[model samples]
Target: MGKVTGFLEFQRLQEAAEAPANRLKHYKEFVLHLTDDQARQQGARCMDCGIPFCNTACPVNNIIPDWNDLVYRQDWSRALDVLHSTNNFPEFTGRVCPAPCEAACTLNINDAPVGIKSIEHAIIDKGWQEGWVKPQVPRIKTGKSVAVVGSGPSGLACAQQLARAGHAVTVFEKSDRIGGLLRYGIPDFKMEKSHIDRRVSQMELEGVAFRTSTFVGSAEDAALFGQGLSTVTPAQLEAEFDAVVIAGGSEAPRDLNIPGRELQGVHFAMDFLRQQNKVVAGDKLPGQTTAAGKKVVVIGGGDTGSDCVGTSNRQGAKSVVQFELMPQPPEVENRELTWPYWPARLRTSSSHEEGCDRDWGVTTKSFKGKNGKLTALECARVEWVRDEATGQMKMNEIEGSVFDVPADLVFFAMGFVSPVQKVLDAFGVERDGRGNARANTDDYRTNRDKVFAAGDMRRGQSLVVWAIREGRQCAASVDAWLMGSTTLPR
Candidate 1:
């Protein structure tokens, strides 16, 4: 360890953020990265725990203590290497991932945990500035070809790894641009598209090919996400590539199938977010959905809902309110009881901090509207209790607790249910009971020959860090399948 007594001496320092008033004026990242000195101090807080729970807690299993020590000792080049060895995209995770690694930190038992994510953000940003993040072109070509569908984090990671291993890799994206959900589902304010673009350029130098607006399925499947600019049948991909990797994200959103769901103002959250992203990119969208000057009601208490709150505030909404059917978690979790694992607790995002009236234990009963236009939401207070015989939790509406909330616009941010079905059907891939592509982590191989699945497509909607892990592991699996052996890290 760089500093034996570091944990006792250094306090946890967070990345500073621009003021809410000033930041709301534009859709740009407001959180500032840590300076070198600040990052070193935060890195020094890593304790000499016998086993680093943060490593296990992190989906990509980042070497936390080693890099923390390296950063503390000013060995930044080594720290960057250690950070990139496990995670392909630390910047993406640093910006958006809810650090479960911090929750599982040994120091979190009593005192504040080390600011690992901030340190990671520092190391990677420094690497980029120093020109250390360059292409790793292989010396020998493997002569094998791989087709990776979807250009989100998972597909990008898989393609990069395979390309570095000397295989010809082509990434297929249905969207006009490369990044799948990261380019559209996430707001630009969280992370600018420039990050994705830079990586795309690096991957191109490493021998990966990107085929944007090219859906790797039937035309009908392409139509599911706005007629992909070009279409490639599953048969064509199978015939041309040695292996096919399904990294397409889970895209089927869960709908609020209640009365008035067909109202004019009610819309899925992604539809609102995708349009805003296009508008920011200088694309003119007729009948574009905007939160400007409207009382916005967002349903769902997850990250997507928080994104909606932030976007609505930026668009000059009159008021924003969020609803959650689940009861509110505690403000803080009991660390003694939940140490070494992610805890169930309340989380307030930057969007929530900006502005939002949040309510829990509430359910929408119906939507009240006029002439097919949404006007208000009829809601009710509900209680969840366990059924004696069934032993399953069920919701019961409380008597005389019905209420109505003013809502000129309603966004359903509940969550995604599964991947777009037509794509899976086009590939003749079997699905798990949960609707994700059926594939185990050990091999990432799908039921079909020469086909594999990874990331959100295989595991359902999940964190970006998890997608990177799946991509790396799936790349190794594909390499082994093609060459009979592989040295690529999982």
Candidate 2:
């Protein structure tokens, strides 16, 4: 610990954002990173809890205490090294992760936790500014080839690691650009694309080849999540590459199949969000679905839903409302009981703070409209009752609780169910009952030999941090398989 009494001396300070009024006019990152002194002070707040639960809580298992002390000592060069030891992309996680590590901080038991995320954001930003981030070209070539499908966080992580391990790695991306979901699914206001661009440059310099607009599946799979300009058969990949890694994210969005789901103006959250991202990248989309000047209602109270709220407001929606079927969680958690673990509690994001009418325990029954255009949503208040047999909560609509709310546009953000089956089937990989690619965490190997799966593709939809962890681990497994042994970290 840099300072034994630092925790008692300083309180946690988070990054500040530009005013909503000003930020809504443009799609840009507004959360200001901490200043050098501020980061140092925040690092000083890291108490010697004897056990750094933040490390375990983080999906990538970052060495939190070491980096904290390094930052406190102003040894930023070493801090960056420590930051990159476990996580391949600290910049991405620092920008968008919800910071479960903070929730598990020992200080969070009774006080505000150390500002670990902001410190990380500061460290990576500084590393870039100082020209410290560079290519890690392998000294020797192993001559083994690897094909990584999907260029999202996980795929990128795995490809980078494999390339560093002296393998000839070629990343196949179905999209026109790299970064599967990060390039399309997330809003630009949260994280600009240039961050991904610079990382791609670094990876390219490290001897990794990127094949964009290349689909690795059967012809019928074109209609699935990733559409490609060119197609490569699974047989071709198997015959050429020594190993194949499926890092494609879970892209099968869960649909609301109630009555009137076919109505126009009702769309999946990704459709709206993806369009905005393309527009920001200078692509002109004709008849683009937007929330401008319309009453908007977003279903599902998750990060995607909050993104819809922020995007809708930015698009000049007249009104925005969010609905969640589950009952509202408490504003605060019982930290005493849930110490050293992620606690379940209400989380109000910056988008919510910008503007939104949020209602919990609300279910949409159907759409009420005419001429195939949505006009309103028929909804009902429901209560969750525990089922004795399953011991799981089931939704029950209350009598006389039905109501209608004006909704010119509706975005369903209920999350994804699984990866597109066509891609998995093309690779001859097995799937779990939940529809995700079936593979154990130990080796991330699928039923098919020379094929492995990781990230959301294997574990279903999860956080970006988790995806990076899986990618790193999967790369280690692939290296071990190809070389009969590997020195890469898990």
Candidate 3:
């Protein structure tokens, strides 16, 4: 409440960005965080609502109004403190999180919501620039040791939290680099790897050891399900660490079992994206799949599909098309029906804005190829109809509507199914019906003693912010289970 009438006086402002033409030339972050004044004005726009829906809407439940007030008062240092109280990685969420908090803002009922994400981006960027972001090394050491599998946002957050709570924490990553999904699965243009690198440096400073290129399973399991440089058996990990957490990503991509699935030039979106990320990191990957000089078709209209479009355009694809099996969402949401919740509406990403032919209410019947090479997709228009008996909508292909989408390359981005099962099998952990490791949110403990699961490995594929929240909560649970009490927050 620095200025009670500030909401009436200010308009929501967006972060600036590089022009698409200029940004497509390099695989660096194109968008810029708000400047100091822009951040202050944005913060001031947060109304003095009786209740803060933005906080609850955020996965981490960030203390939004407090930080907004501090930012409006120009108390940068305290603003950073309030920002970091709940979320460990504001910078990551600020950049990539599809800000649900903004959608639920009280001001959004009738006006543009407060620019919370932009303010967070500004605050965190400034915290780094001003050296306010520093390691919170524990003052006293607890002899208890813990091992965290995977090094994505969730794993990293959990490891950092436990390390700060005076437990010796070690993070395991199968890849040569630490960040599992963030290091590879995401395209460099969306978020440069340098952001992950600096955080790794900070975690190391706080005594959270990172073991890269190391598999934490049997040798046989390592060979079958892991791509690590070294192997550490589950028994060894169990005997050495006081507790263990399975926090890897949901890597089992939902596959398209069409005729040309085995054909060359047809690939899962992550495989295509990961290889490009490694290439951008200066790794020489021979026969790297490229959309350059090819007509590209990306299936499954989601963030993954949008990323493929952006990456393909950067690689000089001849043309790009995206398909969504479901019906198109409304261009604008009905606020009255969906207030304070995530709305179903068409979302045009920056990648889409760059260029893409997006089609909805369509499905690929089969992949069309020649000489074992993918050349096009045999697609068809479809309608969704309700089944009264089942109360579920079913797809009905429209007769005589089959068509071909010519393509030289195709990427399937239909989302993930579950965590890599071999890893779970190697650990002897049980699974839910959906195949995610069986665990409850209350304590995040698995059926096996000394084992816990969180993030995508437990809850299936979700947003990065949700992963961070789960990781934080899981850490608190692990801490409590080890010492019979915990001071750490969820």
**Candidate whose lDDT is highest:** 2
Error of 3 at 96 (Å): 0.4
The reply for model 1, stretches above 4 Å from the true place, is none
lDDT of 3 by residue, 200-226 (tens): 899899999989888877777678654
Clashing pairs in 3: none
lDDT of 1 by residue, 10-98 (tens): 88998999999999999999998999999888888898888999999999999999999999998999999999999888889988888
**74 Cα displacement, candidate 1 (Å):** 1.2
Tens digits of per-residue lDDT, candidate 2, 171-274, equal 99988999999999989899999999999999999999999988887666765545436889888999999999999988888899999999998999998999
RMSD of every candidate to native, in Å, equals 1.0, 1.1, 1.0
- Where does model 2 exceed 4 Å of error? 223-228
TM-score of 1: 0.99
